[model samples]
Target: MSDWAYSDVVPWWPYVFILLGGWLPTDVWRYIGVVSASRIDETGEAATIARTIATSLVAAVIAQLVFYPSGALADIPTWVRVVALCIGFAAYQLSRRKILAGIFAAEIVIGIWALAPGLG
Candidate 1:
C-alpha cells in the first residue's frame, strides 16, 4: 500500500497523492482546452455536436438525481422533486435561459417544501 493510504504515518501524503492523481490529470485537459479554444469555431458543426452532447449529459445527470436520488435528496418526495424541476425549467425559459435563475428557482422550491410543515 502507498504511504498516503496510511494517514497516521504521513498526513500530508494524501494531499500530494490527490494533486498527482486528481488535479494533474484534469488540469492537463483544461490546459489543452484553453489552448485549443481560440482555434475552435463556436458556430461550427463540431462545436454544436460537442454542446449537444454536453447538454445531454447534464440532462441525464439531472434526471438521475431527480428520479433515483440517494441520501437527503432521496428523503424528499419524488413529486416535490419533479415539481421543482418543472418550476426550474419554466423559470429558466421565462428568464431568457439564465442558468442561475433556473437553479435558484429550483432551490427555492426545495427550500420552501422543506420548511413547510408536513410537506417533506
Candidate 2:
C-alpha cells in the first residue's frame, strides 16, 4: 500500500511466500490422508465414524450459511435461503441420493431469485 511496505520492508516475494505458507498445511493433511489410508482399513468403524463426522460438519456449515449467513449472503432474505435449502434437501433425497442434482437445483433456484427485478 505504501513504500514502507515495499521490497525493502516486506520483501519482494512475501506475497508469493505467504501464499505457499498457507497452502503447506493443507498439503500436509492431503499427504497424511493418503499415507494413513494405505495403513487403515477402509471399512473400519473408526473410518466410518470419521466420515460421518466430516459429513455432519459440512452439513452444519451449509445450514449455518443458509440460516445465519454473513457478508453478501446476509443481504439476501433468510426466507430465500431457507426455501432454497429445503428444495435442495428434498431434491437430494428424491433423486435417489444424488448430490449433484441437489446442488444444481439449489444453485438454479438461488440464481433465479438473484435475477428477479423486485429483489432489490
Candidate 3:
C-alpha cells in the first residue's frame, strides 16, 4: 500500500490503469442515464426502458445478495429474502405505487424476520 511502490508507475502496458478502467464504462452509463432521463417522461419508451433496467439491476443485486450472499446477509434464510421481496411488492401495490413505502416495508419485513425465533 505504500505510495512509492513500483506498481503505481504509469508504465506503457500498465495493468494498474487497466484495472481502474472499469470506472469509465460505469460512469458513461450513469451520465447517459442522467441526460436521457431529462428528455423522457413517466410513460415514454425511454422511461420504460430505464424502469426495466432499474428493476432488473435491483432484482439482480438482491438475488445475488440473497442466494450467493456474503457478510451479514449470508446468515439469513432464503425464505426471509423471498418474504421480504414479496412484502415490498405488496407495499408497492398498496401504497399506490409509492416506491418509498415499498422500500420501508421491505426493511420492516427484514426487521420482523430477523426478530422471528428461527431467523435470529
Q: Count residue pairs with overlapping backbones in model 2.
A: 0
Models ranked on lDDT: 1, 2, 3
lDDT of each: 0.95, 0.87, 0.82
C-alpha TM-scores of all predictions: 0.84, 0.75, 0.57
Over the stretch 1-120, how does candidate 1's per-residue lDDT look in tens digits? 655556787789889999999999999999999999999999999999999999999999999999999998999999999999999999999999998999999999999999999886
List the candidates ranked by TM-score, beginning with the highest.
1, 2, 3
Best by lDDT: 1
Give candidate 2 misplaced runs (Cα > 4 Å). Answer: 1-6, 115-120
Off by over 4 Å in 1: 1-11, 118-120
RMSD of 1: 3.2
Instruction: Give the least accurate 10-residue stretch of model 1, judged by summed lDDT.
Output: 1-10
